[model samples]
Target: MSVTGKYGGPLPKGPWAERLHEIFDRLLAAFGPQHWWPGETPFEVCVGAILTQNTNWANVSRAIKNLKEAGLLNPEALFSIPRHVLAEIIRPAGYYNVKSERILTFVAFLMQEFSGDLDAAFSLGLWDLRSRLLSLKGIGPETADSILLYAGGYPIFVVDAYTARILERHGLVGDDVSYDSIQSLFMDNLPSDPALFNEFHALLVALGKGHCRKGRPRCETCPLAGIHLNP
Candidate 1:
């Protein structure tokens, strides 16, 4: 099952799409389906995407809970709340001041451009919506893609640190590759289905958390242990 041998042969010449599908299949077989994007609504998913920047999901969950308790989860309520108040409420998420501003800015954008309707906002074509989202102050590619895939149901692959680590280690991509390039490796290869993209990204995250961790990985028990790197 190794991708390379002691002789250090050349990398597999198979289509990257097929290889990626194989990896996906292996991951799916190992982890089952991951019902990701732990949110009750599209708006909540978008909020979580923002708050999750540079933080863990537990903190994001606590912050979202705070908003829910205050009945401020909707666009109008979030927009009307004072920035300082919002920051205080989400203080547990870390960098609360900046995150509060980013959230408020996103809410304002939604209200002004889409009349506070998430469906309308997401209805734009994929590239168009992604461009609009990336134009916002704090939202970057990962965040934008997360919103597109998980919240808006767009067929776009979301690449993150975990994805980069796995691909680089497996010799599928260089460490210096751009996010778009890495993402295209999945998007251009896999079927353009939001559900597939969602599950694939979740499975990658799960692998990263459990096996392909930072520094020395616990490769022996990794489901991907059979994979060998290119010479």
Candidate 2:
């Protein structure tokens, strides 16, 4: 899987999408769709995506619990809370100061753009919503896709470290691949369905965690090993 430079080379075609689908199907057969972004509300999903940045889900869960306990889980309440208080409450998520400010920034945008209505705020057409989200201060491609696919029911594929690592291991995408390119690869090949996107991303995370790791990739026992015979 060693390549010359990063990204911008030929893409993995042929049975590429089929192989990816096969891996996803096997994982789903084993682990189910995961139905991720577990939250009682869309606002909670969006908040979780923001807080989950650069941290694991366990810490994000703790931070969400903190907000729920403080009754600051809603948009209005979160917006009204003092910055320091919010930061203190989300301290378990790490980088609390910055994440708190980022949350406030999003809440403020929601208030101004959609009158504190998350549904309305997220009601824009898919591309428009993604563009608007990307324009936000702390929202990058992954966060934007998370909010779009999980929270707003868009079909865009969300690329994470796990997806990148899996693709790199299979020589699908290079290390320096641009976010848009990797994202487009999946979106272009797969049918545009939120459920599929959701399950696909989760399966990639599962595979990355279980096999395609950072240093020592478990290629021998990897689920995708047999699928990528030519690679």
Best by lDDT: 1
Looking at candidate 2, the ten consecutive residues that score lowest on lDDT are 1-10
The CA lDDT of each predicted structure is 0.87, 0.81
Q: How big is the positional error of residue 66 in model 1, measured in Å on the Cα after superposition?
A: 0.6
Q: Model 1: per-residue lDDT, tens digit, 133-212?
A: 99999999999999999999998999999999999988888889999998987777666778778988999999999999
* TM-score for each model: 0.92, 0.90
Best by TM-score: 1
Where is model 2 more than 4 Å wrong at Cα? 1-14, 229-231
User: Residue pairs in steric clash, candidate 1?
Assistant: 3-228
lDDT of 2 by residue, 70-163 (tens): 8988888988888899999999999999999989988988888898898896678999988888898998989889988889888789999988
Q: After superposition, how far is residue 5 of candidate 1 from its true place, in Å?
A: 30
